[model samples]
Target: MQYFLVSNDPDRRARWHDRLKAAGLNVTGEYDPSAVIVTIGGDGTILYAARNYLEPRILPVRAGSSKGNRAAFDVDQLVETLQALEDGHAESSSRTFSTLTAEADGKELEGGFQALNEISLHHSSPVLAATFAARIEDDTTWEFPELIGDGVLVATPFGSTGYFTAITGETFTDGFGVAFNNIHTPADTPEMVLCSESVVVEVELLSTKRSSGAVLTRDDDDTPYELSEGETITIRAGDRTVELLDVI
Candidate 1:
């Protein structure tokens, strides 16, 4: 079967390349539309693969000591996993994860960002907190105005164990989760559970200092979009989904 190998580490990449080649697997360094993308690293590598190759099935094999939350198999299991995949015995191990889409000012900022983790908005300046107002699309009566905090996040069920848990100390096996970060009101539990419904949040920079703003980031992306005061960002479930091979 056609396959694409994705890895940041040179040694791990070479090792897998040699092994897969010896096993008679057609592996390519470049992404191919019909190829199964195999990631030979941690969860970060998986996210990178997803960003570059959106539609391919991903099989993430942990390479280093850090067995991240999303890693399904370790490097030691590579041979067996590949054998199973080649034999079509790994079909039962497949799991699908839904994506998220974000829009700003009625323009689509992200068409469909597949985040196995979460999407977040935070204050640009560390010293200044951002002000926000939120409302659920399904419930018009529910509104949170003037939420002064560092930021907010929308996490999928698969992402519950990551940043969502870090902020709220809770996780959910299903449904999306919303959590507030460093809110001014310490007494209030800054978490909410929502069904698969869209959420709209408007952000306002509390600080008037120059270059003060908010940022929108998805997963572990290094770059973030800057948000002007009073800008509205809409988050909802995406149409596209990602299929992950369960190697554990």
Candidate 2:
């Protein structure tokens, strides 16, 4: 089968190139427009590739790790996995998918990508609160919404094991597509709904200039937006879903 490898290791890259060639399969270092993507690094590489290629080709080989992110599978095992696929000894199953779109103030992010993990928004000051607004994808109850808290975030079941676990104090199976909300901080004052499955959310600066904050980060987007007194951020699962070449 046609495959593409994305890695920075000169020696390993060369080694794989030679090995794959001898195996009678075509491989390339650059993103092959018509080939399956094979990320050769750790989880960071997987996440990077996931965003770069989206669904389809963006799969991983677990070369190594960076910042505790893992490809879910390891390299040594990956060697066997790739070989199995090449030998037609194994196949992949299906996995659920979700999309995260980030809009700050009132505009959508023009760059970066939707997060596979959780979407987090924080108010810059500890002494102040930022009002997070939201709209459920197709909910008719609340046309415009708000969540008063120090900050707010939406996490999926796949992401339930990551940042979501850090806040909600709970863990869930990856097979479930859901969201978590945490509003127990001091700045949130009393409290807000700890969790909800609403598909849409809008975040904004509620208080006056009493606090200064900028940017709403999704996955890892660095693009920043200035918040007016009523500026808001809206987040909803996108129409597209990522498909993983399930191996386990």
Candidate 3:
């Protein structure tokens, strides 16, 4: 089987490269058709791989912490895992996770970026809080004229355990989740659970106490898109899903 390996650390990359070669697996430098992408790192590595590659089944090896919620296997089990895969014993141990897409105004973001975790919007300046208006379309339409907070986010079920739970103190097995950041009005914290059908969320930055703008970001992205005061951002469930190898 053809495979592509990715790792941020040089040592881990070299180690996996050698191991996969020693196991007689064909490892390629570039993503090719019918290739299984193997990532050796934490959850961030998995997110990075998903952002850069499409339609490849991913096998995430836990090269970092043992407590990683998204990791499927540890480093010590790499060889055995690959062996099982080679023997066709691990084909059934896979799960599909959905992604989220975001658009600014009417223009879609490049690559139609998908986030496996959550899509977040926050104040651009550190010292000030940004005010926003949010509208949700699920089974019905719900609108909040004024939601004053640091930011807001929309998360998928696969992401519910991450930043979503940290902000809302709630977890979901399915459907999408929405939560407000540090709202100035402590009593006005808004949270919602919507079905898998595309959720249309429109957010407008009304004002900022001291900052000039707000920014939008997705899971693990280093760069952020600036948000103007009256500009609107539309977020919805992505069309594609990520496949993760569930090692047994």
Which lDDT value does model 2 have at 230? 67
Q: List the residue pairs that clash in candidate 1.
A: none
Name the runs in model 2 displaced over 4 angstroms: 8-18, 65-72, 104-107, 111-113, 125-149, 172-198, 208-211, 222-226
RMSD of 3: 2.0
Question: How much lDDT does each candidate structure score?
Answer: 0.73, 0.57, 0.80
**TM-score list, all predictions:** 0.87, 0.73, 0.91
Candidate 2 displacement at residue 168 in angstroms: 1.0
If both were scored by lDDT, which would come out higher, candidate 2 or candidate 3?
3
lDDT of candidate 2 over 16-120, digit per residue (tens): 767777767767766665677666675555555556664544555666444434354665665567678777798766565565666654456665437766677
- In candidate 2, position 3 carries an lDDT of 77
The residue ranges of model 1 lying beyond 4 angstroms of the native Cα positions read 87-92, 110-114, 139-141, 185-189, 197-210
What's the CA RMSD for each of the models? 2.6, 4.4, 2.0
| True-vs-predicted CA distance for residue 35, candidate 1, Å | 2.1
> Candidate 2, clashing residue pairs?
43-70, 133-202, 134-201, 134-202, 202-233, 203-233
lDDT by residue (8-39, candidate 3, tens digit) is 88787887888888888888877785788888
Q: What clash pairs does model 3 have?
A: none
